[model samples]
Target: MRLLFVFGFFVTYGAVLTATVNNPWPNFSGVIILWFMIYLITAPARRRREYWENRRALQEEYWRSSIRYQNRYRY
Candidate 1:
């Protein structure tokens, strides 16, 4: 999926660049809009990935602390 996004971006960028070679203003604006659109499209996926990473870290910390507490109380 990520690879697809990257590939698509490069392909679209190349096409847009070629198509707008004679028009500098449109070329610049098109590239900017393309980047913004890609960012918006990927925002949800990025958020979800961050959320899972944070959750995993919290779970690992909880387990580590619990194990340490148990060991300290053991006779």
Candidate 2:
């Protein structure tokens, strides 16, 4: 489901961008900026940051526990 959502989003974005790219770059960039702004506006900034911190902490813990899984999951 998440894959579908992501795929659909990219497909829509690429279709729009390519179909209208000759229309203008600034307009495309503006839309990109607006997309991120909307995302940030709706996202819980503090909670998301905390979630990331917790995620990193868990990753570190998991790495310390097992070198194999640690290497497997590294960014």
Quantify all predictions' global Cα lDDT against the true fold: 0.74, 0.67
After TM-score superposition, the amount by which residue 19's alpha carbon in candidate 2 deviates from its true location, in angstroms, is 56
The sequence of per-residue lDDT tens digits that candidate 2 reaches over residues 2-66 is: 74686557545754665554665335564566566556664788578889999999988977889
Candidate 2 achieves a global lDDT of 0.67
Off by over 4 Å in 2: 1-43, 67-75
**Poorest 10 consecutive residues of model 2 by lDDT?**
18-27
Q: Estimate the TM-score for candidate 1.
A: 0.60
Clashing pairs in 1: none
Q: Residue-pair clashes per candidate, as listed?
A: 0, 0
The C-alpha stretches of model 1 lying farther than 4 A from their native spots are 1-8, 11-21, 24-26, 68-75
Listed in order, each prediction's TM-score against the native is 0.60, 0.32
lDDT of 1 by residue, 2-43 (tens): 868795776577556746546654355566666777778879
